[model samples]
Target chain A: MLSINDIHVQVDDKPILNGITLTVNPGEVHAIMGPNGSGKSTLSNVLAGRPGYQVTAGSIRYQGQDLLTMKPEERARAGLFLAFQYPVEIPGVSNIYLLKAALNALRKSRGQTEVDAMDFLALVKSKIKTVNLDESFLYRGINEGFSGGEKKRNEILQMAILEPLLCILDETDSGLDIDALKQVADGVNALRTPERSFILVTHYQRLLDYVQPDQVHVLAGGRIVRTGGPELALELEAKGYGWIEHLPRETGP
Target chain B: MNHSLTLDTRLHDRIPHLPGHRLDWMNQFRQERLAAFTTTDPGGKQDKQWHLSAAAAADATDPPHLDPAWLERYRLPDVFSLVWVDGVFCPHYCVREGLPAGVCLKSLDELSDAELTELRPDLTQPGLQEADALMNWNLAWLQSGAFLRIPERVHLEKPVQLLCITTAPVGLVSLRHVIRLGRNSRATLIHTQTGQAGASGTTGETTAIWLEQAAVLAHYSLQTQPATARHFARLDVATDTGACFHQHHLALGAARALTDIQIRAADQVSCELNGLFYADGNRQTAIYTRVQQAGSQGITRETYRGIATDKAHGVFEGLLQLQPGVRKITATLQNRNLLLSPQAQIDSRPQLEINAEDVQCSHGVTVGQLDEDAVFFLVSRGLSEAEARTLLSFAFANEIIGKIPLTACRDQARQAFLAALPQADIHQDWL
Candidate 1:
């Protein structure tokens, strides 16, 4: 139940996304395919409520709430998760510690019981195994000196632990090798269900092979110029965004 | 009442029973300094290097008045409490039988003539140059008292505590503290400085203090000066061969303070210095240290770290000087700081002066704000920014806290450090 209605975004006072609209209902996956500088990451950052972004005009409603009004932390506590393209490294803060604090913060906000140290260790260790990350990774400063693959796996590990209602994967497939990409895609696919929705942001059609989207929208010039079923990804892979110029731009959300 | 105080170089009235020829080196050193005190200003125009700017207006004679109306109103450690009122010992307020045998816990002022003479062979030598404040300023108008000798080859496994309560609300208060720990002797001294709230609940006054050659002294210097206080303390420790000096500086509530601490290691002696300071509010602290390796085959290491919040400023300047022919000397200084506020400042300067090529030396300095990537990485997992920063501080403290060597003391200090923080940031899962 995530909706983006005429979302126009600007970063550093320059408009990056002119006017974009997308909606993900329950049980469906939507992928936004675009070339570099196509406002893919900007859209995700705007939805996540990163600062220094001007909406100018338009509103995004997530599960029937004014999403723009909430802080990045508030959005997170409300079950909005954004798996960053580049996970940050926090020296001196271990991965496990950050995960537990976040999990507890969200759980506390929801009036739910939080997990203790023993349960958290037991829980995250299993999640680490899924991401193919060693337990030592959890002991390190958050992303401090971690390899590119390890950072992505850490993002997936966090997603597994938080279990958000809606997750926005912003270019998570970038810089990931084939095997790592498969593992990440598998992690995303494993979490998909009728109750949860995902907005998969990527440029390639290969990830779509493992994570078949219910709808594939070809984004160009800050707007979705073409929309079609999963087959559209395979067709566009054969063609490219260069051919999207011939397609008619969608008029409405 | 006006108090006329001067740097009285004559701390002792030429003792009659003193050893005439023995300890000639100490006698000659003091004579030379005493002769030059009038003409040569060893401590020239006051500079920020000594952090004595607050004392520019007040000459050595103008001592900050000592009155107990303030300190007597506050809560403090009740063990062997002693109050130093404007270069005078109030009294040893409490005497605990809990002290171990062979431990002579007496303030310099309280020492009898015989006891003073026994220690005078070294104690009366001279004051320290760590700040260039003359011995007369300290001994002449000495405000803070002392924790004296623990005899040779004795182990006082228990602790001997000394609390120096500064009650003077204004002006300068000179402190002369001399601790002489004998050969193969061991003892723990808890030296604390406490301040009180202002007359209208604002805060107390700043203080100028120093601690002299605490040879073989295991000290814990804890300061809780008031928020409205700006103070400077230089703790100089000169140790002999086969001696150990384990010192820690814990600063909790002081607006602005600096502890210029130095330790000299004679050959075959072992020493470790662990200094911790938290600069919150507009609090600023600069720690400048110089460890001179005058003797061969010695070892020393120091870890200095602090957290700067609000508009606070934190500094660490560590210098290791290895004299010529002083080989096999091992030394390392690690300085780390966390800047919470965007405006907070952290500066680190680690220096090494090596005369011998066969010595080992390592130094590191780091100053960084709360890690943004770390915050995002943790937040993506579910932690708030606050949780992320708090956890980062924990990890930083652990790396240094582990180097404390003493288990019980380390644990106690860790608890105090944690209680002052926002929260337990590093989750048990991370460990």
Candidate 2:
């Protein structure tokens, strides 16, 4: 479903992700594990087309189309979603308002009719229930004054509502309690299907315990040094990223 | 010394003499104020209050183009509306019927000698003596305005809407409003001023409000003059013990606009002043507010936000003064500004003077651009960059617009606000 070939990315003349390559097929959940400053976020941001990041050399293909050519909103409309590590708090812009705008924009891109208010509310209610958030959250400013756990859950709720084909979780497990972690995982599990894929960029193995991945890749030195099955995550959890960091360069694929 | 008080030769010649029967006290007050006004330079740099408004002293000598249709655009239902057109009272647009008992709403011209004398004390309270030249100018040339009196224990649920429309392209429109609320009275007053697009004129208004014990008053002022118009407005308020006063000022359009709000609170009184201003396309807007806590145990809160874009310049100056020996007073002031374009500029000054030791006062000011990460977040959610910017700007201004006491006014103002944005595709329906 996605092909990132030798994507060399940098920000502000400083290299972040150097010669990184990965591929994921349909219906497969891929977990990219790495130590601190290992370019995990750079890869996610590069895929999402965030500004200020320069792709020095590489090509990213999503469903056979060049992803790097699209703007951020176009990427979102094209079904590429990135769950930010830090969701912005937009005051006076209600969460529900943003969701409706996003949903309609996506629908417009797909040549579908805009959803009515009643139907949109119903859809939001169902999705929010899956994320275990109160209906009152829809009336509030987008994530304003929300707790850490509530923010993560809100991200999950958005993921459910948008239902993008390719979901990239950039450290979604960070700052979440165990209960919230499980709730987020369960929310993602419910959305798993043959046509939808996920790239879970995480630093810990605890998140993988709930939402098991088909493949686990160890990212060290800005490259995929090791690629293995779900057992690799358990092994990393036991040995820690310290062991991965000291491994020999140009190891495996 | 032939020290007769004088105005700028150009401005004095353009402004007509005060109309109606002027009482001895009113005449004396005007002369004293005008004398004081002549001594100080208009928009003096020596005074911190007038430094930002120095360039707003333009001449208004053109004829008035009175059109009734301007008032029709912003009319609300169930409102006792009064349309002031180009320094004149348009009887065809005034609606005072169906007023509740003990509620009297009329123009100064409609009141008799006896009625005017009865309201003399409230009108001549020495609220703003000589601190501002425009205040004096308003008193000297007071030609048309509204006067309202609410008796004791009376409550008027419906709002009184005052629409001031100016079609004059180089004329002066002076408006004076007096509102006297008896003990335990309650009312809401909305004042909106708009001019024609090509109109080159000046609008100076002075609003005096008296709130008795336990009285509550909500005052809303909206200034939307055109690019060729200059607007100078002042609101003077005095609240008695246990009274509560709420004021919201929104300045959306003008060539150069200055709004000064001065408030004095009595014992245990509460005052809330909020303002939002946006200036673009060479427009300039200045909001100056001063609050004096005279009586003990009073509370005052002020919040003002401004947005400047496309070479527009905006300024906000807030002063909170706690009188000496006034115990248990609490005051807070906040000013937040956003510069959307590189050429846009903003100057925010929030000051506090405290004489009483046992008081809690705080002030904060912030000037910044829209958060880039926040913009990206919204963009990642499928909104275009322009769409994201519009939403953020709308949200910034909505914080103050949401505080409108009436839903009808809120909705109307929200629509007007959205229309004022530079984006052509942005509208209320889309949001």
Candidate 3:
């Protein structure tokens, strides 16, 4: 239920994403594989409404609403989530406090009452188990002094709790070990529903082995160079992104 | 403007009636301090040591007597409380009728000759003879004060609050507080000094703390003076062998506020100092801390956070000194400040004097606005701009507030601190 048409994005007068178009229907998991500096993270930031990204052209529609015009908080209220590649460490705000505030804000936007402490605790406890994080994380500051793996797992734990409609995972597997990557992939897999969608952006195809995507798109030089079934990821993994640059320009399905 | 003449004139008039006038040694001490005040400059501008604070602007005229209804605002139940109104101890407002045994809360005038002699050494400690103008001024014109003595091995579960409320009109109110912790005693002291909003007055406060061996004392200084009021506060602490001292100071705002704190630790002593200061409008706040670890194995840790908005200014000067003979000493001093507006200013100076090469000493200072990435992250998580700022501000001050031993006091501290935030309409709910 998301549509993007020829979006041209730039940062500091330098073109990053040049004329990109993509659409995802309900319940579909789309994987965007690209090399470094291919604008994978830029796309996630633009969609999440982060400041400093200049969108010179094109429109993005989420459920027929203009997503580009909404503020970052408004976008979050509308069920768009982006898991950061480098999660910020806020020394004073606890992870649990953030999660509760986020959940309540979302609920308030949707005309729902705020969650009480007991129910919120129960919900957080159950969701934390999915990422193998203990309850102590609830009291500690958000990602403050957390290990690399624990931070990734905490991001996944947040995803599980927020239960957003469209989840954008930006290199969530970069710092994770194989076992941690499997756990994160499993956590993402379990959250998949007929009404939910995901856009997994990664440079490596290793994560694809844990949670196979419904569609794999190869992004090279800031544009979608190739689009195919899940086998495309395997092909790229076996042959690397160098061969995709030699292919013809019009390779998208 | 120089205040030496006006201060000297006032000291001459009030020397006869100052507290402890009946005691010969106390009078001699007062006279010596008065003589020092006439010679030394309070601002230290010649040495460039008071660059941030520049000058002491407190008025030296005698304040118009005022007896306002301020006790109701600061009174908390079940704790021994004392009230000082406009630098005068208010016996009618004090609540110490049935204090527990081994606990003594008395006005300086009420101390017996024996008690005075026993506490004279601590009261007349060399640190009390500091050459600082503010210290000398406080000693010379000190009009009212309290003497708190926690007997040996006495443990106080409840806090003892000293509320100093200023309602003086266009003049200075000078006072002193003496806290003596006997050997192995444990106590908590909360000192709150507040003035009428926008009142044009000055408050000079000095506190002396003496901790014997194995004694522990938690001291909190909460200052919420008006934007038009000028306040000068000095705290001197001395800890014997194995004693521990925890000091927390929170300043909201004033026309100009200056704080000088110095602590000396004996062998195996530990000191933790935390401070949070907020300045809004055109107000200014400055805190200078000097910690001397004279004994081996002594530990000193200090952290200070400041928030300045509008054209306000904030300053922090921290110095950690390890004596030449001291070894195995560990000290850390950190100052972090946030400027909410471009015009706001903050100056931080963290210094270390490690005479012993084997000791470990570290200092860090940072000055910046809100983290853009952190604010954006919080906003993307559905918090409004105001909410995100409030959350960050709360977190910045949470470390200091968390050290409050009493939950009720902690909550009050949090509320008062949040209410003073200039960034947003910060509420206590976020905290």
Candidate 4:
């Protein structure tokens, strides 16, 4: 469903991702593991069309369309989602209000009718259970004073509501506890479908324990150095990223 | 060659026909105020922030017919309303029925000699003396305004709504309001000022509020004049022992608008002031607030937010003073602003003068553009860039509008702000 061919990314005239390429088919989950400064979050941000990340040389194809040419909102309407590493705290916009507006905007782009208020509330109430948040949370400002775990779960709640095709979760499990990690993993697992694809960008293998990935890619020095099956996460966990940093870069697809 | 002299001459020519001109005491007061206004130097000419033009004042004739639909938009539901059209009270539009006992709501001209004599102290209180030009001008040309009074131990159930509408195309509308809450009394007042399209003159309003011992007063002032209009408003409040005062001021319209608020708190008094100002286009809106804590154990909190887009300019100056011997006083002042365009500008000054020992006072000021990360977050959720911007701007202003205690008043303030916001297509329900 998505293809990145030898993409070189830079931020502020400094090269971060050098000739990195990856591919994901429909219904597949790719766990991108990396240490500090490995460009894991940068990759996810670039995939979601975040500004300030210039793709110097590469091409990204999503569902047969040029992904690089689409604006951030256009990419989002076309089913691209990125769960930020650190979610922003918007003080005045209520969580539910933003969710409703976002859902309506997505639906409008797909030429669908706006959801009725009652139906929208019902949907939100049902989806909110998956993230284990109270109904009162919907009335508060978006992550205004939310805890780290709550912000992560709120992101999952939004993902559950929007139901995007390709979800890129950037460090969603960093600050979460064991229970919140399980809840988030369960939410992601429940949303898995044949038409959906996922990119789980993380720094540790703990999140992979609950939600197993189909492919595990060890990213070091801005390029994938190793690729293996789900057992690869356990291998990396057994032997830390120190060993992976010395491995030769993989030249395979 | 002097602008104040020219304005004085023009006003002098119009005084003979002004309201209350024949009343001996009222005429004497007007003459004194006019003299003070003419003699005051009106400093700060070198201050770029003082952009008020002397030519904004003009002579007022009879106003044009006001549209009922326009008036209805600002009318709050289930309240006793007193409507003023072109600085004159309109009895046909005023809702005077069902007023509770011991509550007096009347036009200044309608007050009997006894009532006027009783209210003289509050009317002649020393507040906003530094703004001699505007204050004295308001008194000299005081057309007509409302006087609200609640007796001791009386609690008003329904809020009183004061609606002032300006329909004159080019004229000055000067109004003076006196609100007195007796000992242990409680009341809420919603004061709204709006002008019809093409009402391109100046509207000056001065309101003085006196709260006796243990009295509580909640005041909401919303000014949404025409884009061509110029508005100057001053609010003075004094609280006795244990009295509480809460005020929300929203300045959302006019080409040049300035609001000055001064408050004094006695022993153990509590005061809260919250405000929001939105200025777009070439509009200039300024809010200056000063709170003086003169008694022990007084608590004061002031929060203000401003939004300026296009080439609009916004200014917020908050001053908190704790007098000597006022122990255990707590005060906080915060001003946050948002500039939406490169050309848009905002000046926020939060000053504190602490003289008493064991007093805690803190002030914070921030002037910044909208959080770009927040904007990106909203945009990545599928909203267009414009929609995201409008929503964020609305949210920034809502931080202040959401603090209004009354639901109806909050909704009215929200609608007014939304209407003033640029590129605002987002629905209120969506927010």
Which candidate number would show the highest DockQ if scored against the true structure?
A: 4
lDDT of 4 by residue, A81-168 (tens): 9998999998888999999999999999999999899999999999999889999899999998999999999999999999999999
In model 2, pairs of residues that clash are: B62-B170, B170-B200
User: What's the C-alpha lDDT at position B79 in model 1?
Assistant: 46
> Scored by Cα lDDT, where does model 3 land?
0.82
Q: How well is each residue in B1-431 modelled by candidate 1, as lDDT tens digits?
A: 21111222232333122222234543454454334433334332223433333323132233334444555433233344455543345553445566656666655556654655576534544423432443333333332356556667776666655555544445455555666676677677766665554411111121222222333556776666666655556566666776777777777655667676666777777778888777777777767777888887878888888788888888788888999888888888888787888888888888988889788999888887766655554554555667756766766665565555555555545655665576654434234
lDDT of 4: 0.88
**In every candidate, what fraction of the native interface contacts is reproduced?**
0.52, 0.72, 0.64, 0.82
Model 2 - which docking category? Answer: medium
Where in model 3 is the C-alpha error above 4 Å? A111-113, A251-253, B1-17, B22-32, B45-78, B112-129, B423-431
CA lDDT scores, all candidates in order: 0.67, 0.83, 0.82, 0.88
Model 1 chain B poorest 10 in a row by lDDT: B199-208
Residue-pair clashes per prediction, in order, are 10, 2, 0, 0
Which of 1 and 2 is the better model by TM-score? 2
After TM-score superposition, what is the CA distance of residue B196 in candidate 3 from its true location, in Å?
A: 3.9
Off by over 4 Å in 4: B1-19, B45-56, B128-131
**In model 2, what is chain B's TM-score?**
0.89
Q: Specify the poorest-scoring 10-residue window by lDDT in model 2 chain B.
A: B45-54
How do these models rank on TM-score, best leading?
A: 4, 2, 3, 1
Poorest stretch of ten by lDDT in candidate 3 chain B:
B45-54
